[model samples]
Target: MDLHPIEIVGRHPGPKILILAGIHGDEYEPIAAVRRLAGQIDREQLTGKVTLVPIANHSAYLRHSRVGTDQLDLARTFPGSADGTPTQQVAHAITGLIQQSDLMIDLHTGGLAMEISPLVGYMLVSDPSTLQKQRQMATAFGLPIVWGTTASLPGRSLSAARDANVPAIYAEWGGGGGCQAAGVAAYTAGCLQVMAQCEMLPSPAAAAPVDRCVIEDDRDTSGHLQLNYPAPHAGFYEPTLPLDSTVRPGDELGRLHDPFTSHTTTIYSTQTGRLFTRRVLPPVEAGDCLAVILEDPAETGTTNE
Candidate 1:
């Protein structure tokens, strides 16, 4: 695995912030954002080091697919074995880089199949202090939403960082394998804000006020805001609502139609939230994720409006 590490060292020593992108090859907004940022930074004015990996999964990036040539997802192979598959090797190298950073940000999007809204997320750690650190970083990223999950699932890039006790956040915005100007600009600006927050660079004169929505894991309750809607059966999907559309419970999300059987099923929203993700591909398979519903922060009383 060939790792492209773009490092910018400042005149004065400070925290090291690592920004990673292209973990999923089909997501291009973050890669472009990071590359643009790398070109704009003035090293002489910077106080710390900044490392940017514009394309984390080179093979998948070339193919414009989520998985690499080895038929593996790089995001799920963190803390990987030294002698392992190609994806695993890449994961190991990425983990090593995370270990060397004071703060980290993993950039992601919905990829080829779906579109996503801009959001920042951190992993829920065992220690209160560590979790607090993660929260601060996520909040500082200036995204409207901040989500925290308990434990990193095996092989996830953030899992390695969590295990290392590093403060990190994952950012998602834009998707469908195409670049959006707004998405790229938002990501680039957000990266700069994070660097300023880390004290790696001077703070901007007027930082944008973030209307934050905090999502925490509470599995025991039905009020959990983050929700995933999977394909009920294999068919062609046609979404009823646009991405980022606000909805109430019982709202029709889309329809899944079986061409061969002439059967149609309507997908409905179970809770009040924003439609952050929706599958763009017409072909679907049973158990495939079709849409992601995020509970409205106002309804959940988690909004900083």
Candidate 2:
């Protein structure tokens, strides 16, 4: 209940948007971008307020790994108990923040294990109005990939927003190491563009990418990025495909060389699409996600025209 959020109040009245980052500790770009934004807003020319949670899960952040010392992933423990584990308490506090917001943007990166192409994604909620708002927000964020996926997944910050009837979106960018400067700058500009779209800031519409690929997939696991390309054995993963590479079904995604033996297992792409994510961390467990090949929307019949 003692979550400290940065509040930037505008002189005028408009929509109060909540911008969140650091839901996972290892993802640094969002946290840095949020901090930068705290100092960049011009209250004199703005409307409404911006509430920023630069580090939503301090517990996880302190550990320097994806999960906290309690080994709970804050992203998957949302709307948590008031008196639960530290990560759960953080989730509960963020849920409260989401409930009081008119708009929400949760930012993330691939963390230490994965690299992701820059993208803005939203849940494919049932409400048409919310969905439209989300689509607009994602567009305004101006990422190369605008993704709309199934909303049935629970325990996420977006799910909490959905329950509170608030339109929300999240952004992801390059990762698998320390925060990249490009990722930080991109996130800052993206947040400002979203604010402009919400009438909280004075700026022209964010320039839409000339080659943007907008996708709307309702498959139950469309948004589940970590559930793909599981390692056949716990070994050192050597990914063959790079991020955003055009991948064909049956193409080798990567190889897992047995850490204890000379055997290597080659993982193949299951769908024809782009390689949206690749594992940068070599040490992998049997079930660790090695890569995530975003299925081609054309094949899935889920393209946004």
Q: Each candidate's root-mean-square deviation in Å?
A: 3.5, 2.1
The true-versus-predicted C-alpha distance at residue 192 of model 2, in Å, is: 0.2
lDDT of each: 0.82, 0.89
What residue runs in model 2 are displaced by over 4 Å at the alpha carbon? 204-209, 301-305
Worst 10 residues of 1 by lDDT: 218-227
* TM-scores of the models, in the order given: 0.90, 0.96
Candidate 2 lDDT, tens digit per residue, 5-111? 99999998889899999898999999999999999999998899899998887878888889988899988998999899888888998999899999999999999
> Over the full model, what C-alpha lDDT does candidate 2 score relative to the true structure?
0.89
* TM-score of decoy 2: 0.96
lDDT tens digits by residue: candidate 1, 200-272? 7888667668788787753332222223788888999999999888988799999999999979999999878
